[model samples]
Target: MRPWLRIKGVFVYLRAFFSFVLGGLAAGCATVGPDYAGPPATPLPAAFTRAGEPPEAPRVAAWWNQLGDPTLASLVERAFAANPSLAAAQARLLHVRDMSRTERANQMPRGGADLFYAHARLPSMSGGAEDGSQLPSRLDLYNVGFDATWEIDLFGGQRRAVEAAGASVQAAEANLADAQVSLAAEVAQLYVDLRGCQRREALNDDAIARQQRGLDLARRRREAGTASDLDLARLQGQLEATRADTGQLAAELDGYRNALAVLLGLPPGTLDDELAKPAPIPLPPTAVAVGDPTALLKNRPDIRAAERTLAARTAQIGQAQAARFPRLTLMGLIGIGGSHLSDLAHLDDFTALAAPRLRWNFLDFGRNAANVDKAEDMRNEAVSHYRAAVLAALRDAEDALARFRQRRVTVATLARAVEAARRAADLTRERERAGTTTMMDLLDAERTRISTEQRLASAETALTGDFVSLQKALGLGWAESPRH
Candidate 1:
């Protein structure tokens, strides 16, 4: 070959090599998975009508703090730290992070080492001079080698896998947050119910005392032949019913206490002493912000988590589709191994030479095609799930706002009914004493007073419950909490 021609050929080869390297870099940039597009913007209200209301302040970390009950706050903190379900969710997030790491490793170079050693024994040579056969001989052999493999990611399949894994990690993180929100809301609701039960028990205790007094008066009248036996028995029944209510409320209180203890990851009955004391449910600050419905999409952990999952499934579809294309893998071995350790450092060993390899799964076309189809189907399912979650969230918010407004009205009405009933009961007693009213009238008045009082108590409980529900609907359990 001419010297000038050789130079030209070498230059041509150098240009091709550089071009190939640049092409590989460009291909690596292309991630095979479905590119993630952010959630579709849903039309939302310009502003929240209830925004101006004196709702409780929103809290981001430990929303139970807004309840303003020290015990409740402490319990919520403990639950966040120790609850098994929450812990499990957190662990799942960590696992997904590791899985992402594993996928990323596929984009990196791989190598391994190998060592080999052998020993051989040779029998004495039979043709040696008379009676002078050679003694058995022993031989030893050693070999060492190194090996490595790397996938070029020509089709971006590995990149897509990594992208999917990363999305899964994000989804898992959102799942943990969702668990926290749910746990906090549940704890708060149970605590509220417990407090309400205590209030009812107290009210019933008062009613029992008043009914006992009425019964005693009835006994005095009957002894004087002024009241009938039927009147005394009716009074007795009223007293018994009042006492039963106290027991019922007490039982309900126990159940709630037990439930709270379990939520805090404690053994049954652990909270009996702490929660046994009756305390009113803490109300959120009036200025708490219930941001617009659009804001809720961001605040609600479940919604965010579901959206992340959808994104991950979309990425998986890309990964699956990439599998249908050619995969270029570069594999090499660089490790050294020997039967004897002494030979490992020898450069002339069997594995000292550089080795490069390539692999491709060019067959099984139908299987790869099916996987791509399945991934696309899953992506579709995920999109539907995300949409459903958004609708459900909006419904919850609307229901809570309306119910909260109605509860306030109901409470006001019940308060008036309670006052009127108390006055009627007083008037009936006064008239009976003056002999202007019969025993039957007094009994009717007593029943009406107790019924009204019960209704009032129930309404009070319901009002607080509605408030809790509204907070939950607003996704305020973790986003907005009351002030200290």
Candidate 2:
């Protein structure tokens, strides 16, 4: 037959084969395994037991801004821009998206060109006469052509793989968001600690100063024989203790600042100058916008990631199930060859080939079934993981809310104690000026006020920390967080 006619025959065969396969892929039969439904819904509480007052509306994405601390907000932004962990998570998400695209691309036909060259020398016939019955022959062969192969997704294997990859991309996205949520909470908590440490230092300094004055008054009284030496020694002890506490607070303040610098991906001492002065801890609002547990389950990033993972695993089951069925692949090739460059132009030198390949593991004695079983088991594990994540999220929110509630009580109590002590000190000072109270009595009242002030600072700091934890548990603040 002429080369053109042979090529036409090959094209005809390929055209028909690919038409059938592509048509099958376009509107294929149902996939082999069960379709993916989401993880089972978890039961949720009606309202948080510790929610003090219902918020006016749902909390916005920028929950940290509600705390009213510009410095904390700035610090969080800096961390988002520079934190290594968050950067890695973002990279992983991109990688999964790329994989999803690659898998989806498999649904379409593939085509590529190949070039080949070959050289060979024919050997003499073994039973021929030595006198050139079969002479040594040498030939050079070269061919170039386009080749194409497309696997028809008759059982939806490729589609299921693409589905799983898409779900994996979503899971990776949720992971990145979860990382951001945790990072913001860490920065806020550290900032709160730093502020608390500075506040305590100031309180310590105030107490030390007050005690020094008391010691001075006692010295004058002892000289005048109006106060005992024991009183002076006791005042000295009180002053020394306050000074010691002040030193510890100063050390803790430096440590917290350095930690904040690390969290922002900066070297130690980077934030020292900026945080040198004392600042008030950010306060939380009275009514927190904590939606019900069911809504919270929907919003939490960890839970979302788990759910997506389950979806991906469920898709894997279909992919495995599809493997048990036969695969139909359509492939075709065209090429040209000749002993001489001039001969390559002849239609007789061209060659064309077409084939429809079918593959199955029909004789693998239960290997495919075992794979299906494994995939199903993994899918079950994913379902369990998703449930566990939901339970953990609920527990975290409940605990944080409970702590925030109790912390408020503690803060309020300390505030009242400090106020009462301040008033008592004022009365004692008045009594001293009027000559009705001794110097010792006045000094004692001042010490009480300063001590109460220290407690109030710590309680207030803890309350703010609890608020940050609650927001983290609720998975707020990431949507508005700076992304790098």
Candidate 3:
């Protein structure tokens, strides 16, 4: 054959080979196993049954800001930036993203350049030494080459692997978001508790002061023969009890401060000076907007992560099924080397090689079949888990809503009780000044007012805490700045 004709024939052969490879890939695009349509839908109510108000769109992202407390907002932001758990979640997300990228790279051709040098000595047979003299007893070899390999995804196994990896990456991201939601809620709750404790402590201080004054008066009256020992003892006992309650409040305040500091990734007592001054509990808006159940499914990170996990598991089924088929790999190498070291300089003396390898474990004692069965089982488990997640999310949101709504009612009732007690105390004080009521009557009325006020403070704190829980259930706080 003519040289030009030979070159043309080679080009034609190369073209045909590539066309076959491409056609195979195009046909193999139909992946094995059942395709993932989407997450299975779970039945949900149109609106939360316990939602007191009309359903409206919830401002779930950055919901902490809606509480109208800048300090709580700042703490949440700080926690997001520094909390150890959130940092760990972000690291997990990064790891999965890198793994996903690696899976994608597996779909492309792989090439490497290699250089090898070696010296070897061969032993001669004593009886055949004269005949062995024709062969060299020692040799030095040097090789430099570029080699390439590409595994054709003829059954879309590699493609399914890549798909699974991508879904895993999304799941990791959702996990990170869930961490953020939890962290923000934790910080806000701790902050509210701290403020509530401070308020209680302040009230306790007033009670202790008033009880001391009353005790002093009772002692003076006893000394003057106007009061009995029983009266003085009762006054002293009340003072002691109030002082004991103050100690408990102090401990609670310290604990809340320490917890808040830790959530911000700071050492215990770090926030003491900053939070030493008492502040009011952050209150929720009058009309909380909680979107429908469908919105909850989309917003909640746990649900999203679960759904992604199901998708990844579904892809794994296809991957396992594909494994039962054959794999095609194309390998090629080009190099130059010779017996003499100087021969390495002769570029024209280089050798070239190419091969296509096909492998199939046609009989592995049903191992591939077992793998496919396991994969299908895993997918089914994932489906169950995803449904469980959806149900759990809905239950959580509804529970939070119930608690918040009831807490609001409790707070309102307590506010009314506090108001009535204050009015009674005012009336008692006036009656005492008019000589119609005794000092004890005024003292008792004042105590009642303070006690009711304390209860109101506690109820207010719980309401705010419930509000935080509701926001967390709605998957708020992950949409803030510096998102991963």
Candidate 4:
């Protein structure tokens, strides 16, 4: 046939082949297996059992700022930026997003350029001389070409794979958000504990000073032959005990600082100089805005991650089902080559090839059916996991709410006790000055006052810690922007 006629025939064949492929693609829109219809509905209460008159609006994203502590806010922001765990989660999100892109690209044609060189030697085909020695034939060929391949998604297998990949990317993003929420809460809790320790240390200092004064008074009375040796010994022991308590507080303060440093991605003790000075514990606002349980389901990162995972598993069912059908692949190559390397550049001396393939593992001893069944099982497992996540999130929110409410009551009661103790100490001091009570009575009153104050400080710190937990349970620390 003439070269021009051959080229025209090839064009006609390619056109018909592409038309058939397009028709097949149009018909392949019917995906196998069940289509995803979103997550199953989980029964949720309109409001949390422990949340009383919570606000309708969702909690703020940066809930740490509600504590009104600049230092804590700064620490939380630092953790978001530098915490190793959060950074790792962010990297995972990027990795999953790239994988999703790869899956989507699978549905499109792939083409690449190729350059190849070859050298070969073969023995003579005819009989050699009687001596059995002959020069071998030599051949060399060079080629430059462009090749393309496309796997037609005739049963939506690739489509389902891409869908699953996209869902997995979403799950990774939610995981990153969860990491951020956890990190922020940890930073705040440590900071509160550090300050609370400092407050207790200060109380110990005051107690130590008071005990020293009582000891001095006891010494004067003993010299005056009015106080017993036992009284002086007891005062000295109390002074040393107060001093020992300060030592414990110092160690605990160091621990809190170290933990906060680690949460901010710094070595332990890195925050020592910054947090050594005493400060009041960061206090939460009187009324925290905890949204309803429905909002909690939508806002919690773990719940979102679980739901996305379920979606990915559901898509996998279609991917496995589609594998039971045939797959069609089209491949084409166009190149110029000859025995001489120079011919590689000669456009007129060219070769062209087009091949179409169909593949089906129709007789695999039920392997494809088993794969489909396994995918369905995975999807069912994911459904259970998603439901479990929903319930766990609800439980966390309710438990945090209850703790926060009860902590507030405890703090108030301690505050009242502290006031009562202070009044009693004042009365006893006046009595001692009037000579109506001994120095021992005055020392006892001061000890009770200091102890009550210590209890109040500890309760206040716990209340703030509970507030941090509440914010964490509400999934309030992650930003609204897409993390990955």
Candidate 5:
């Protein structure tokens, strides 16, 4: 063909290719996917169910510290440093961060280099030299090349992928925050239980001592023919019951001690010596600064993590939808190759090539469509989960609030009951000393007072526990942990 004709043919082909690419570019921009809209607004209550006017209280950001216990604060810090669950969450956060970087790199140019050498010899049956008189000989060839590839985000597929990855990192970080919250709650609850058990154990000890005195008096009365055998047996039975109660309380104390050690990531029994001594149960503040429910969005890590997961899933739908469209990639390479290594020394021996590739999934039957549908379903599931999390958190807070209120009331009532019983017992003791009341009356009065005091101790501990639960429901204490 003539040169002019060949030139015309080249131009015609170039025009057709450009026309195809232009059409693809327009279609690529018309990406098919549903954009994410936030979940529907949920109506929140104006105030908590059991809101009350309490004495001015400290803020609950680090609610654990509000309890005013140095040992408990130190334990929270130790758990932050040593809890295995928190460490695992941190590791997951790092891994997700690196994965996000990997996804982002896909949208940018990626380059690599390779240097290679090969040695070869002709087969014995093949001739290596042109003269045919020379035998086969080995040859050395050197090659070096650098290549780069870049994927254009014409349809925003890679952009969606990167967005999804970033959301995943945020979700992972939220998971770490959630772990911190759970860890602190666990440690604090165990600490409260330990103290409560100690308190109950001491109560049991006092009850047993009081009964021992009653039994001694009954024995003297029986020896003097002033008390019946049935009365003496009754005293012994009561004393034995108190002793048994002490045994159970001691066992529970041990269980709490071991559980606390585990929360601190120490061997069981490691805290035996530290916790063996009895101490006052850490009490909650007289009042609570529980912010309104709107704060749940910011304060609750589980909710935040769930929201981020939904974001990631929504981005995945976009990525999957983009997969059904065309993708364009540009690849380029520069190389030096030679039968002899000396050829690499000359710039003239250098070679370069560039290519633009188009990949269209026009005939995958239904794979791309299926992926899009799957992603959409997954996104829908995430939405449901997010909503469920919100509802559940609200329910938890409301329920905790109600329980804390009732428990506090119960503690106060018992406090009054114990005081009244103590006063009555004191008057009865004086009456018995003045020979106005019988020995049996004095013993019964003393037993009632001691039992009432034990009940008060138990109720007070429960009130403290309920307060902790309320703080947990509000997601208030996790920020107290280091860098949650």
Candidate 6:
């Protein structure tokens, strides 16, 4: 080799060695961009209040089971298994997990193989050829090769990308949990509605029986020439109105059952045979101890999802920053390939030849800069979203608690009204027997009693719904064990 060329080669080797050392130092000693520390803290309550005191709340899983209905428990379980939307969410989580695994695999070595065949004719080089003309000679050739490629993570770029993908997988998993929580709550609410419908149906049946008896008595009095025509007409009208209301209530009950059936993922019109009977709603406990508000940040799936998203965005910034630096890749190709069919098994020939390649893009500095800027913007957006989600979650819990407390008082008041109305109905019946009041008066009292009963039932149903809402707001449904 020429002296100058030899010296130049040595200098080139020294430069490459120093570059390798510098890249290692950059990777090991420094990571570009901000490292993620969790979201900032906000003022939060230590515990939720109930009935003006701190309550001892039991941790319950399968929270819907607290309603004390086995059928409802079964229905919710079936819906979770059969609901197409929930199944789709679960599938999405699996897909993201697979994608994350694939990304992680990308940061490591990859193996590959290849085979080829070629047959081409070329002009002979011999001058003795028949009247050899002044033409360039050509030849026939055949070759085969195999290769492999691997990118060495010199700047932790690939590693950061894998880290971001893993966080995304975590976010997807949390989303699946959120879906489950929502489905369970929906099923519980529907079940409560069904029970409320049954209660109303019972009230209607009682009202119709009482009104029919009043009409019969009025007819007897009229035939005996005691009750006036005006009184008889009033009784007739009242009885007919009560009958109409009964029919309407029955129809509404049927509608409620149908809605429940659909929520359980059953075909329409299938609930009549199984759920026709009137079932009373069980009262949920008045004492519920909601833990510290900060606990929600970990217990709630939506909160976890937001946190994971933040982590993913934080890692993405590293990936973007790495792009600003030169990329170093290690590449090779190796395969047991041959032209002839028999030569496929010949590993010796294949092992004799392969190339290790390296490529680096020296230009396009602006391209990498744009990527970094984009990543930074996305990171900022994620941070904002996470903060907003946390605040929203806190508000949901507080609002649900406040509503539940107020509904409890409303239900108790309605229960008292129902009792007073029932007493008035009994007194009116006594007066009708003694001739002090007409049949029309007794019918009015009976109808009022029935109406009050229905209202009380409705208030009870509302209270149940509010309690379930509180459960969701607390994010207590996804505990590992049953919280009964």
Q: Quote the lDDT for 229 in model 3.
A: 91
Query: How do the predictions measure up, each by TM-score?
Result: 0.83, 0.92, 0.93, 0.93, 0.89, 0.84
* Candidate 4 lDDT over residue span 1-484, tens digit each: 6655655565566557766776867864667778889999998887788986456765657888788889988999988889998989988888999999999999888889898889998866544666766645888888987777888887789999999999999899888889888898888888999899999999999999889988998999999999999999999999998888877888898899989988889999899899888888889887778888878877899999999999999999999999999988888777768778889656656677778889988999999999999999999999999999998888999899999999999999999999999999999989999999988998999999999999999999999999999988888788753644
Which 10-residue window in model 1 sums to the lowest lDDT? 348-357
Task: Identify the superior model by lDDT, candidate 3 or candidate 6.
Answer: 3
- Each candidate: RMSD: 7.2, 3.2, 3.5, 3.7, 6.4, 6.9
Badly placed stretches (over 4 Å) of model 2 are 1-17, 24-28, 55-57, 125-136, 344-349, 480-484
- Across residues 69-152, which tens digit of lDDT does each residue of candidate 3 receive? 888888988998899988998888888888999999999888888887889998753444566444666889988777778888
Which residue pairs come into collision in candidate 4? Answer: none
Model 1, stretches more than 4 Å misplaced?
A: 1-29, 47-58, 120-139, 335-341, 345-350, 422-450, 479-484
Query: Model 3: what TM-score?
Result: 0.93
Candidate 4 global Cα RMSD: 3.7
Model 4 per-residue lDDT at 86:
90
In angstroms, the error of model 5 at 299 is 1.3
lDDT of 1: 0.74
lDDT of each: 0.74, 0.85, 0.86, 0.87, 0.80, 0.74
| Residue 398 of model 3, lDDT score | 89
Q: lDDT score, residue 483, model 1?
A: 15
lDDT of 2 by residue, 228-340 (tens): 98998998988887787766787898899998899898999999999998888789987777887877876798998999999999999999989989988888887776666
- Writing each residue's lDDT as its tens digit, candidate 5 over 290-332 gives 6677776668888888899998999899899888878887666
Candidate ordering by TM-score (highest first):
3, 4, 2, 5, 6, 1
lDDT of 1 by residue, 33-61 (tens): 66889875666765555444544345555
